[model samples]
Target: MISAQNIIKTYGNKTKKTQILNNISLTIADRSFTVILGASGSGKSTLLNILSGLERPDSGSIRYADTDITFLSDSQLTEFRKEKIGFVFQQYYLLPNMTAEQNIRMGADLAGNPDYRETIRAVGLENERKKYPDELSGGEQQRVSIARALAKKPDFLFLDEPTGALDEKTGRQILAYIADIHQRCGVTMILVTHNQNIAEMADTVIRMNSGRIETEQKNQTKKTAYEIAW
Candidate 1:
């Protein structure tokens, strides 16, 4: 389980500081799909960054099981993230020169995971493995990005607006792939998005407003990606 206690984060100096997260505390169960839902500037993304160890909280403790990552040094946190966390963002940050297979391999190599092709197949990119980023559609590139992240076999997968750049159909398709991957791999998935429709697919939904958690709900019956009212 990932547990965070009293997380407080801010930007800028004391004179003109802007608080991003305010005393946020939450727990994410192992191998569960979680959604952080909020409008823009609601601090959902900042909270995700802290929870995933991409950023540190000014005053809080973030623990993954028994390990408290809040105290880790920069280099230690870097190694920790490299080993245990995978991330996908709205932007496909693939190297233009690399093939889909090669880009996925870059992540797999980090964890000595030679079965990177399996991730490609999991994301339904078997036929496009040799294709470069420029040759693929927006949705295909995002699939490649997801596959690349999964290739590392991380315990937790953090995605920020994974489908924000795509159209409705493409977004749904991407979400379906992500849902399938979570079910198959049992990876803890934490997704940050503003769309309430997307929250229906998660086991847990955390709603944030103005740097604070407005509500957190557990879905008694989770919906499939296709069932969500996107």
Candidate 2:
């Protein structure tokens, strides 16, 4: 489990401070699918960054199981993220020259998972493994991004607007793959998105407003990606 206590974050200097997160505290259960929902500048993304160990909180404590991650040094945090966290973003951050197989393999190397090809197949990239980023469609590229992250087999998978750039049908297809990965791998998945429809598929839904959590509730019956109302 990941726990945050009295989390607070800010930007800019002391004289011109802008609060991003305010005394946010929550617990993300292992293997649970959590969606962080909010509008622009609502601190949802900032909170995800902190939870994923990419950014630090100004005044708070974050614990991953028994370890206090809030106190870890930069290098230690980097190592922690490298070993335990995987990320997918709205933008496919694939290397321009690398094949899909090579890009996914790079993530696999971190965890020494040589059979990452299965992940490629999982995302329906078997035929496109030899293709480069430019050779694939927007949805295919995002699938490659997901496959790359899944290749690591991280304990936690963080996605920020994974389908924001795709068409409706393509977005649904990509989301289906993500949901499939979650079911098969049972990884702790956290997604940050502005779409209310996507929250129907989440085990836990957290809504943020103006740097604070507006509400958080557990879904008694989570819907599938196909069932989501777009």
Candidate 3:
């Protein structure tokens, strides 16, 4: 039940304000998969950060379940981020020194939760758990990142170009992994991708242009199984 109503976010001062978002409103249904599609610099990241409580809106309301996150103190936002949200970035932000297993465990440990060994195995990385980031391939690194995020058992997951660094074949496999995690975990997911091919696979595709949602499309006829379930 994450709904952002008429969310507005601007950067800079009044005299020279850059409107990053303009009256944007969207909702992430419980256990739904969504894709936010936009070109570079079209406010995609800004919108994602706002929803995840990493940034605040200038003139808008954001609600996650029962809490209104508009003016939450910095400390409160930090706690909320740690407890509620999981992030997967394009770069696969894993520590250089930590093994894949250690990194995955660390993410949950920070949030005061149990390490999710099953998710690690689900990502097909149980054998590589002892390997560090530098030792793994691009796709494997992404899997570790995904496993780490899922280890948090977050209420929602935000993935920014989850497959950006991998080859085409590897990217598709990564997407399948994401689909599997989403399905098995029953976690709400919002993926931001510049690839239109991937966007079409989402349950709902939110097209954006210049900081505004151009249109939204839903594929009611497409079976959920067709959505990249690996």
Candidate 4:
């Protein structure tokens, strides 16, 4: 379980400080799909960064099981994230010169996961393995990015608007792949997005407003990616 207590994050100096998260506390169950839903400037992204250890909270404790990551130094946190977390963002961030398979191999190499080809098959990118990022479609690029992250075999996968750059049809397809992978691998997936429809697919939906959590609901019946209205 990932537990966060009184998370308070602010930006800028004292004279111009802008609080991004305010006394937020939440718990994410292991192997569960979670969605943090909010509008622009609602602090959802900032909260995700803190929870995933990409950023430190000004005053709070973030614990992954029994380990309190908040106390870890910069280098320690870097190693921690390298070992335990995988991230997929709106941007593909793939090396232009590298083929899809090679890009995925970069992450797999980090954890010495030799069975990385399984991840390519998991994301349905088997045929596109040799294709460069420029040759692939937006949706395909995103799939490669997801596969790269998953190849690392991280316990937690943090996705920041994974489908933000894709069209409706492509987004649905990507979400389906993600859903399937989560079910098969049992990885803890935390997705941050502004779309309310996406929340229907998650086990837990957290709504944020301004700098606070407005509500956190557990869906009694989670909807599949295709079942949600785009």
Estimate candidate 3's alpha-carbon lDDT, on a 0 to 1 scale.
Answer: 0.86
Per-residue alpha-carbon lDDT of model 1 for 1-230, expressed as tens digits? 99999999999996899999999999999999999999999999999999989999999999998899999999999999989999998998998999999999999998789999888888889999999999999999999999888999999999999999999999999999999988988999999999999999999999999999999999999888789887
lDDT of 3 at 37: 94
Q: How good is model 1 by TM-score? A: 0.97
Whole-model Cα lDDT per candidate?
A: 0.94, 0.93, 0.86, 0.94
Ranked candidates (lDDT, high to low): 4, 1, 2, 3
In the predicted model 4, the residue pairs found to clash are none
Q: Which run of 10 residues does model 3 get worst, by summed lDDT?
A: 221-230
Off by over 4 Å in 4: none
The backbone clash count of each candidate, in order, is: 0, 0, 0, 0
Instruction: Kindly list the per-residue Cα lDDT of model 4 for residues 33-58, writing each as its tens digit.
Output: 99999999999989999988999999
Scored against the true structure, residue 137 in model 4 reaches a CA lDDT of 99
> How does residue 160 of candidate 1 score in lDDT?
96
Q: Against the true structure, what is each candidate's TM-score?
A: 0.97, 0.97, 0.91, 0.97
lDDT for 32 (candidate 4): 98
**Model 3 CA deviation exceeding 4 Å by range:** 12-17, 223-230
Cand. 2 TM to true fold? 0.97
